[model samples]
Target: MQNTVSSTEAKPKKKSLKARMQKFGSFLSGMVMPNIGAFIAWGLITAIFIPGGWAPNAGLATMVKPMVTFLLPLMIGYTGGEIIAGHRGGVVGAIATMGVIVGTSTPMFIGAMIMGPLGGWLIKKWDDAVQPHIRQGFEMLVNNFAAGILGMILAILGFFIMGPIVAAASAIMGAGVNYIISVHLLPLANIFIEPAKILFLNNAINQGILTPLGLEAASHAGKSILFLLEPDPGPGLGVLLAFSIFGKGTAKASAPSAAIIHFFGGIHEIYFPYVLMKPALFLAVIAGGVTGTTVFSVMNVGLKATPSPGSIFTLLAMSPKSVSNFIGLILGVTLAAAASFIVSAIILRRDKTPDTDAASLEDATAQMSAMKSGDSSEASSENIENARDVVANYDNVKKIIFACDAGMGSSAMGASLLRDKVKKAGIDMSVTNTAINNLKDEPGLLVVTQDELADRAAQKAPNAMRIAVDNFLSSPKYDSIVLNLKARDQMDSSAAEPKPAPAAKSTPSGALDNIDFAKISEIDFLRDDDKVGTATMATSLMKDRVKKNSKAATVKSLGINDIEDDENRLVIVTPEAAKNLKTRYTNIQVFSTKDLLNSPDYDKMVSELK
Candidate 1:
């Protein structure tokens, strides 16, 4: 049966909208994720250098101002530009971002994200337009001058036009947030923040908008709830905790370790795939967010600065030196976790089959032990759309890429794991990791991304086969992919080896009988009238299949006249065309197309021109 939907069937518009949102989320995450190291460094500096901090030297404290003002924003711009183009783009991006940074005391992280990519894209367009017209000898001269002039213009534009406007916008946004906090309506902000964070826009919300406001508030009051709003681990903790208890099979076993890493280690990205695996669990996160924020607001507890990775320890380390603030923070996390776990557990319980027997706890434990021992294999029937159609031409794949939120983290690790697998399998294939934003459409490519980012990956690499996984670090799908590639390689090798043709007879009194069959390297498909391209299309199809199956056959299409009298060539012709070829060139090898196409030893027939 064909795997397809009817042409008249309309795809759900809601899904399309969600996909667009996810793509935008991916773009925003890309701009911020790369600068995470800088955020961590700055977080550490702010924690130690403030007036009441452990190392509160007035001179050392002053460094924090310039660090956020210049260094962080410039790093963002450079990373954004590198994503769009390369090193040149990064240089121009940093230069352009300096203008925005100088124009205001507020951090220009969002503005830099915009200007950096814009600068790189403009230069890319210019290079695309000019490179074709440049003389070979003068190419180097033109390239350097063009980039320099373009960078200067962008820097000036950033200073004169973009800088002030973005500053005004940032001020207005900050004021709005302050008003919300002043009126004690700040907890309502979680309505928007929780959803955006789940969509992978956590960094954008935390660093781009909330951080600026929190910085101002902390400067005045020594703490602000804005710092805690986006970075709170309560919601993620709640979801993972619920999964640990209520989730089935591997999900139940894995959620405990994920919880520890998420709460303690502070890499919140680990839990994203868990929520994405069941989007309905979004409600649990939202509920958790609202509950935690409400607690924080009621208790009037806030952090001194934004926590970089949102770890519980870091959040505590950055908290104001007060007992009530500490209690409130702990209470908020506990209540949110309780709320989210309650809701998620209910959802999971409802999803379970009423008639199906639950796995025994002992059996579940043993299964997990087996998985840890490397005895587990990926089940083929995992949930994915158009799985067969996606890999319909699996043999054509020459490249495979893994894409993730931060190109450096999970995607890079996944690519490395798969590369090791391919190396051990002795396959000649290229496997690598790239940011989803940096990917472009190419033939003969396969892209693997987490389920949440799969839509964005498809849009970026439209021609490539795409496989979506619930988790990059531990997916069973890779096993199936490896098996498929190995099978294709084996089939191709077997098909390429030469085989004896069926028509063995005593030598006849003809020039063709003396011709050596072993010398033939090229095979031609002779056609009569291809005026309508019927023969051309057929020849292309035949050639592709033959090439995939054979190692040495240089297949080609030819009109009778185009057939060369080379000793190393053999031709397949239709029944009518064979009469003319056989009469005119008795020394040249020829076979009927019907005979070759119908032959049982297809690989042997291809090799021997049967």
Candidate 2:
């Protein structure tokens, strides 16, 4: 049965003024909240790992340390893009976003600090340069490639200059923080703040105050409102309050999820829906947040780094040396949660409800079921059946190539992950990591890399099917590679029970029928004295044959610099195959694997001959 609401439902009412304000606040909170996880992680690491005698870790030194450095900057870039351009804009938007992250954290705010503006500038430049140039046919693809290049270049430049500036700024900020806490705030803060921290606010102040100052010892401390509060007091109290005030319905139902999420996941985004629905409740949250921050500040209950939000795990991970700080964090979180719940409940109790609560529940359930069904169908069709089924046969696959910049870091990691995954899938494909420059013109080559680098791979191997990974190391998104492999395997399997071979066909260039000159060993132009020049000339000579015949072909030449004979054409070899060819022929023209696969001229020539 078709649901009437799906077809002609009226738009939900415009959010009230208070609702809008709450949303704005939520957005603000979102910016700060998500970073809490990072902060907690850093703080915990510092508290546990860093030596006491060493200089207090600040943003400069800490940010560059391995996973946090790369991940945090990238996250900033991605998140910034999302905020500005929604999801699609995120691609270029992230470049600008990283700028903000760095700028906000850096000391003198010079050098790589300019990355934020540079990223923004590059996005604008790309938009201007390509948006109008985009036209029909292959031009669209080209323009997209140009934009990606522009974004990447801008990101690299921005990071290069900004990284140091930000680092310096971070150092300064850290020094300043140490000064403030040790000289000014610690003495008084430790007394009152420690007590209040038991409720959760002590941690809040520590983070909020230290983060901007660049003294964020605990990474999570400065990232979110809840991070300042202790987990137990904050989320646990919130749960009880949600139940007592909102009652045992959907609002109540969501409360537990919110509690779990805020307590464990450290995601404040989950609580956004609740605040959006009840605008007045926003003030309560702020009051709770401020109260929590103040208490945390006075108690001097510090965390190690940021985690998600106010999750107990994060606080525990980042807590300072003193056990009292942990106690403060718990007390602070509980108090804040309790306070928020009380205020929210009091405000909600007076509201009247319709008598059809049961009906509402039934309708909600039905809607949820329908949504689930639709989602399932879409996932099956788009994510699984069509895209994934293309390459099912994995056994026959001989080689897997991973392409990326410098052929290091992310690509290496991705290849390793894929190898493990393929092994589990019972596929015996050999995986190798290489730069785009090293790709050969071989048959059955698979190029895998991040979407940003796909264009370069395509240029190197135009005929090879490219699989774009969403992230460097995410396993779920690796399905595209797996599916493509599976598809290829299936094709191989199908072809294994081959029918009778077709009659040989000759090419317009008089090349042997169906024979790839590139694969043939008979061609030997390498004997020519001017081998480099002859090989260079051979590429053009073979262009016509390549255009006419879609078979493996090559022009070679002898190494002698003086020879000017046509035989010299046989010695041409691509850079990659040069070593292999050097041992056999004095001079040889070797068509690259890519050249054989992508030579449209060969396809044309072969088609004409047929």
Candidate 3:
């Protein structure tokens, strides 16, 4: 129900913790992803102009050093600042970053990430404190002088303090990477890499952490193995190959198409659902990763740059135009895929579990969350806590934002899709897309995020009404939202278009078997512990149905112990909640449903209520 968990519940906070880590990792990447074009330009120049490169132009090679040392880190700082305080932030961020840049021979990406945000924050705080007190006509003068002075101070601080500290940290990290490579222990990183990728943290790991390390290593050695770790599609390719041959029904049919998109189109996200459907596939990917890395290590191959989409062509393009490295790279990818496919095939053939398709992405997430929290029994039922975490009132919803790890791709497309639907429905609303880290909690804010990202969205915007969707391209949730908005005009006057999707079988078999209808004057949805959100939603739905049908019964969601034991009152709950309620009440009529969020049976029961 309401996603509120009981204080005494022993559930692990793994989901929330993972979300926070994802958020932080994404923050690091957010500074770099936007500047990928710059990174690519430098990559291309290095690939073609260095003495060992194909064209071997010493003059163009000079561009490589300055680009990597100055242009890239400055861009990162500017972008990072832009994220914090907008245009002014970018200016000061670059100024602050220049300090760190001139202070060290190493690339200043990590330093820029820190100083840029710090610079923006300082200016923002100063402006907040000083702007209001400034005379109206002198706003521009005061702001300009303030930014310049602050930038100078921050630049001095960065050159003197943050720069060396970050340099030492980077040096330590570089030494660690060198040690890992020397001992051939880097391949073991895939144990964490493959799993985090499934959680949609691939970009964060690759661009945020690995890319910087790769850049640092590549500058000296002309290439880095760090870049290949996260972007290598070998393990995912192997898992998909197994799924196509061994997966059954929807999963099998979808595998071929997903595989094509993942391998050719470079959308690795396409295969995540497949691996998640059968978590044993984790071993397959991990095996593939280990095998692939071992192969890469033995062959002495590395990419000159990070592959953006992890597509084969991109990977090939980023690799040095050398036959030996090319063959080694291909061999690594092939061996990795073969390793994963073998493990995945055996696991798939032996386990005859029903297919879990892309459509059930959210369900899979909740179940996985449950399992991780050590509550496997709750996995068979609906969400341990309902998907919709309603900390704010729907009536306060005035703005809707679609959020994702990277704000540019899916979230934008999803926002545009929903914006069109809202427009078509004649609703005036601001539909926008933003990075999850940028979520601002305020009244009238509603956030729609991809199924896997729901937890992160919640932690960011707990005060915003939230909706999680399986696919941004098409979703009944979008229609339901539009209908809910339209229904605001006549919340109870008539049943708004029966929800976009069929309402959970209309009636769960035998759930409402023996209920006395005429005697009940009020229907109560029990809200306790994790059931608060669900109970609140179910109660609202029932009230809408009763009002639409002109029924006499009133519906409300209340604490489980708040309702008195009365024959005239009816209580609706999940089977688990029903048991707890029954322990406390003898006369109140209690009914149960496996899915409280989408039960049409409640509509039926409400219509028949006195």
Could you say which candidate leads in lDDT? 3
lDDT of 3 by residue, 1-610 (tens): 2222221222333466777788788888899887887888889899999997889988888999999899999999998888889999889999999999998888898898899988888888888899889988999999999999999999999999999999999999999889988999989999999999888898899889899889988988899888889888889899988988988766676678667767775667667777876788899999999999989988888998888878888889899878999999999999999999999999999996656532444333333332322321121122224322211134456889988887755577678888998897677889999888788776777788777787777667766667666556444456446544543433322245564322111123345656778788988876645655676787787778889999898887765424655778887777766544433344677777777777767666766776
For 122-206, candidate 2 gives per-residue lDDT tens digits of: 5655666767766667666775676577666655655565555566666675666567555534333333433333222222333
Clash pairs detected, candidate 1: none
lDDT of every model, 2 decimals = 0.68, 0.46, 0.76
Candidate 3: residue 62 Cα off by (Å):
3.1
Give me the runs in candidate 2 sitting further than 4 Å from their true place.
1-44, 52-117, 123-240, 244-249, 350-356, 359-610
**How well does candidate 3 score on lDDT at residue 195?**
94
State in Å the error of residue 547, model 2.
83
Q: What tens digits encode model 1's per-residue C-alpha lDDT throughout 221-243?
A: 66788888888888889889988
Off by over 4 Å in 1: 1-15, 199-224, 247-250, 267-280, 298-308, 317-327, 346-400, 408-432, 440-445, 485-610
Q: TM-score of predicted model 1?
A: 0.66
Query: TM-score per candidate, in order?
Result: 0.66, 0.38, 0.68
